[model samples]
Target: MLSNPSFLVAWVFKARYFPHDEILNSKKGSSPSYAWRSIHNSLDELRKGTRWRVGNGRRIHICEDKWLPTPTTYKVTSPPTDFEDFPMVASLIDPDTRWWKANTIRSLFLPFKASTILKISLSYNLPEDRLIWVGNKKGIFTVKSAYYIACNLVDTVEGACMNGLPTMLNLTTRGVNSSGFCPLCDKAIENLPHALLHCDHAKQTWSLWQDCSVNLVSLILDPIDIALNLLEKGTINDLEIFFTEFKGACTSFSLHQNPSATSWRPPPLGFFKINVDGAATEDSGNSSIGVIIHDSHDTAIAALNKVLLAPYTIEVTEALALLHGALFALEMEASYAIFESDALSLIQSINSGVVGGEIGHIL
Candidate 1:
């Protein structure tokens, strides 16, 4: 509650010390306590999920502030005739009716953008604007959701293996399991390669699975070893088939569960469609990208979700997603794949070859 004076810490500072400013706008005072100064470190993390929940809209800036629910640029992208004219979002509202001035919005912005503004329902008795979390569907934050996000953002495979993704061998070594044998099958010691590849249950699953490229189970090499070999050999098709098969198998292996909503569509008779999307919190460096591949038959061949180490403008994130999508398609041997993204500016720039911003380098 950095912006709210109701919280104990915020109230104390507001009442006695920084009466005129909140934590977000206030500076570290002269010779501040170590604990007070340390709070600055987490302010970036806090800003990532914060967005103004429009009420009277007096507190939000029309172009500079994040009040809209839309992605990419949360603020208005359609340049105003004069930035100073509508500096505050309140200027665009019908103060007496406590509703948006619809015609004013239309004249002020592009038609599509005006529609977005119109869709925002207004309250009869307009209240003060307050910050809300956009991490979940509901505008509330929960530790359960936050923890889930943190765990998935692990940067290293070894670190991920140590976290929640453990094989029977890992459990046994940690004294969590009596023997290394998989609980599902007593066939052999269950290391990652064995449970996911050589186990009889895994073998049956792969034998019946629809792969875009290769029948990895039929190969003499271990499944994990084959993936490693493909990376070394620089062969795309076999690499694609191997991972596609494994990604499908991972659902049964109980790796990561994705909760993001997706709409499905089949590609052309001989092509695959690779749909890509990127997410970022405003002013928060935390960003992630996702790619999902579907074959002509509408079967999901493979999917990947990754958190980027460096944050970029949403445009660059989409460009990065496109880049990753192309690489993933190449790895899977989908030479006839089509890339799809929500960033219209990026796509238009790609076609024109007159790119701008950080995404230009990625393209």
Candidate 2:
């Protein structure tokens, strides 16, 4: 349980001691078994191992967790000024995008390590940090989903993991013989936002969607931003359906498709990220609002949930929920922040500088 903590084995030991903490934070009891102490020594070695399976990054330390992917301590040669400032790898991640903080990493570590860090593709589904046995070249003991996701990452452009199918523009950069424009409609240069969103074929495909046709009109943002809007405006099930349909559309567009493959990128460094959402009961004319504030370290600074007595449209409720959260943040003096919501229409209105409807004053 202590050494290979997974599922039930890890839970039992954790419950016994350090229930609210990690195995790394546990101490040997007064009369501990030989197994307990043995695991402690192994944990120390893994901490200094060459590669650790990255998850939410709440457990591993930055400098002291030298057993980075390279495993050769030479990767991150730059000495850390202080270990206390960033005790865990969580500080290295951006909570908003759920990806690594590139700027902060480049500023902190050497080029070799920083490059490795950036190449490490994160996942859209935020999972817990896991382990891959030392000397396991094939990552046999690692999470299967993450390994598959890593393979998919290769299909994406250098920076965007959710760029769908590479357009003629990217193909030309790779020395393929073709005009760098849309094949279906030769009017514009084909990029990620254009290939899957702005293209005439893509537009027609999305037009077929029934439940959320409004999203079809609001396809001005990148896929990642669009995903965030969907999550805030709709539910997980809704997002799943959208992605499934989107994948179909991309596949029909081209065989070289990389659809619904997403990675968590953290919000910008030194910025707090707030995720706001609302749910309403049509029968009761009541709604509930949820707001959570997290710093760059992925630590929740504050969180709140409120029940509204009156009924309101989904858009208005989401806007009100965001307003409530923003006010809460201001009360606590969290100025530099990136607010996130699933309400695409509300966000579009705010971004276009054309606030309207009931939430115009709030915007």
Candidate 3:
């Protein structure tokens, strides 16, 4: 059954052949033994060995060929106990089998034993620090899974398990349960659609951009399929918007989850970094806005400067610094300049294009 693809099909057909509750409860001992004994008696004819037929019973044969056809099966059974069994198993399997050449299959089997080690380490509450070195005799798969499981890390979102981390399968850890919540909104926890499309707040935001033309409700009904469709069509802009919406929804959810229910801060559009240093004691609020432009490298390409108007509030000082920098960039005939500030709200307000607020007037 393990060797055949057809066995899974047969499993569906034979699912009702046994009484499920009875099969689940029956054991070799502890309970009344009649049910198990009857099952034992029914299979008594094959007790001698599957290799031979005695009495009027069915017969079965055990050969590696029955499981694998064409090439005679190879055997390398005498591997050292400490070694991983896969290398030997792979060596035994037909060298020409398509699975043998695939990198995906190789990766899948390499961790067969590592997963066991991770579970053991996690069970005993071992220290959580340190990268799990693969193939180290000191480590196990179970412990590695535990370390990953605790952090809720996953490889690329659509992984069975994180590359070296554990998965939801490690249910032994605490505070995890099987509930479907929108990755965006957690309030009336349900499916992705409910959180991203059906949520009143989310719907309003999406409607603002899409104008109800995108069939968001239906798309949300099968977000995964819609997502794949977008990808396959190479609709990069739509995908970006979907991701942005999804992130917004999640942030909104996280905020509501807190006891005080603070509202979410929308993600910043861009940053303008402005660094200012001045000494107030020496009348050296001779502040200068040092504007440096670099092309993604720490090396400076251009440096420009301006004097400041205020030095009291580092807030006021930075505004003057940016104003000077902005005017300088304009004078130098540069198209745009990213203004940065240590004060978050000020930078955020400007980046968001919400000028005419208090900080806007001050600057």
Candidate 4:
């Protein structure tokens, strides 16, 4: 039910379960069920992760509606008294060229925000406004995503426990116990920082995960400070991997054992492997493409790096890089070459012999 916008709008309006022609049209009504009322009250939270994809922009008010990428509505520190009378978003766009008026937007909004708004391309013929669910990659809401979001918002205690922080250490400090000795390490008190960073097992685990070299025990004095630093700078994937490995290493040490190391294998003989990758900057829309050709022995034969023009999505950039890599291999006159890319969607599309979506032409 959460995944279907038309159904949700009907539900919110207390209309019949059947489809309605004016579902997207603005109307106010009420639902008698307490559960539905509760859900209706929480719609504001859902709106935070949703944005309007500008089309004709006729229905969207410049200052009231949120069409910008930023979370906040379009606003300025100080404005003219008649700012409320400013025209719809369509006014800022030139109908003849179907492009945003650069000078007008610059005068109305901050320079950075104005530039971001300009980069978004409108259709040659104006289309209807689209409400995109930014919470999911496909721009559609799901109960699973909503559940996770709710859990994140309401389960603070569970979050701290899962992070391996020692919340019970305060009991020992209040004279509830003689000492807060660590269960895993008998040498030090079982404080949050000590268990996660300063313990002997933690030190060994940190050494094994050599990519991140921060010595939290030495550099950070308070556990809260360390948490803040990590929260501010850490990537979700990096933090998850770090904690999983750290806990596994600690458990192995507790059992007086060592974890086995992983080994890398080379490609099969008689085939040349070509690896291609691409990266795009969100702020500037600039992209870079890279490709490398390696033999069965895992020795590099050729490499190329090229900077591409602005205004390309990450998927499009990756597809372009793959095409360039294949062309490069053809130029080298290589036989039985194996192309590889990190994008599984591109690989699947190529294997299926079906090209679709915005980058369909390029593929």
Using TM-score, give the best candidate's number.
4
Candidate 2 structure quality by residue, lDDT tens digits, 1-363: 533456786787677665776676577766666776787666654443324456677766666553354422312334444546657878878989767888888887656456656645444444565544433323333455344444432343233544535678888888899889898899999887787788888887665455662476555876667777778887664555455445434542111212224443446788988888887554535667999888888888899999764444465577778887888888878889888887766777778764422244445
Tens-digit per-residue lDDT, 78-99, candidate 1: 5345746557989988987666
Clashes of each: 1, 14, 22, 0
Query: lDDT score of model 2?
Result: 0.62
lDDT for each residue of candidate 4 in 1-363, tens digit (9 for 90 to 100): 334445655565445422353233323344446654565566676765556667788877666565664322323212322435546878888889767887887776655456667755465456766666654444556677566544532354344444444333755666575567877778877676677667877666455443443455356444445445656676554444444433332331111123225343446898888888887764555678999988899999899998764455667677879877987888877677988887777888878764423333345
How well does candidate 3 score on lDDT at residue 303? 63
Give me the overall lDDT of model 1: 0.65
Candidate 1: count the clashes.
Answer: 1
* Maximum-lDDT candidate: 1
Give me the displacement of residue 307 in model 1, in angstroms: 42
> Which rank order by TM-score, best down to worst?
4, 1, 2, 3
lDDT of each: 0.65, 0.62, 0.36, 0.60
Candidate 3 at residue 279, lDDT?
18
- How much does each candidate deviate from the true structure in C-alpha RMSD? 22.7, 20.7, 27.9, 14.8
Q: Give the winner by lDDT: 1 or 2.
A: 1
Q: Which stretches of candidate 3 lie over 4 Å from their true place?
A: 1-187, 190-193, 211-213, 218-222, 231-234, 251-363
Deviation (Å) of 23 in candidate 4: 7.4
Name the regions of candidate 4 deviating beyond 4 angstroms.
1-39, 71-86, 147-363
Looking at candidate 4, what is the lDDT of residue 197? 69
> Could you tell me which residue pairs clash in candidate 1?
240-332
